[model samples]
Target: MSVQHPKESWLIGDQGYPLESWLLTPVGAPNTSKEQKYNRLHGSARNCIERAFGVLKSRFRCLLKHRVLHYSHETSALVVSTCVILHNIMTKAGIMLNEVEDEVAEDFDSPNNAVDSSQYIREGERTRSRYISTL
Candidate 1:
């Protein structure tokens, strides 16, 4: 779902439900149209973020451990924050030690099931248009 904020569209999360099950357009016209569009797009986009976070947490063991910093709450907060920043930087730079992407499942859907064809044609045309436009 997408949240309407002042400056940005925020993707809340995705349910395990398939996109083919979703109605492409909103039930009500004009009034809820933007909302339905937002939900579908946001739901799709958030899946990427969910996968990225899962990768980060699973690969970075340090994120799971707590550290004492100067025996103070404020200092500990600072330390943890610093560590997280450093971790992100290292990961981005391809320096952090972690499991390879090849071993991880990047797709947000179930592995065994084949791609559902109900929405494939429309989705493909949208994708193709986007792809061609980028050329």
Candidate 2:
């Protein structure tokens, strides 16, 4: 459920984060039904993001919490961005990273390959419904 923008990706955040064009956040106290649904979808998306962080840390040791990045703030951010980009490329190609030497496996699929439209819709609806019930 990544938001596609002209220059960058859509980033979903919680209430504490500042609102920006690229940043989709939930309303603290949703009044309208539409706002409530938006909150549910935003919450569901954030759940996916949190799970992605877990997977990212597991796949890349540099992102592990125990390892402190001694780089400057901007440099550290760049390092993280680089790692995430690599992770996305590897995942798209179905490349499993077991060890340093294992990363050179044959690529399976292209990142731009088409996938089932319904599968994505069903998954999104399921995620949203699951989030709705928990509220």
- The C-alpha RMSD in Å for every predicted model, in order, reads 12.4, 15.2
The lDDT per prediction is: 0.43, 0.60
Writing each residue's lDDT as its tens digit, candidate 1 over 1-135 gives: 553444322214233333222212111111344444544454455656555645555555444435223447667567656666877888799885654332322233332233455664355335433332343
Report the C-alpha lDDT of model 2 over 1-135, residue by residue, as the tens digit. 564666434566555444445554455455667657776666666666677777677788888878989999889999999989999899899987543221221111221222335554344334434444556
RMSD (CA, angstroms), candidate 1 = 12.4
Stretches of candidate 2 above 4 Å error? 1-10, 88-135
Model 1, residue 38: what's the lDDT?
A: 48
Give the lDDT of residue 97 in candidate 1. Answer: 62
Native-referenced Cα lDDT, model 2? 0.60
Residue 80 of model 2, lDDT score: 90
Steric collisions counted per model: 0, 0
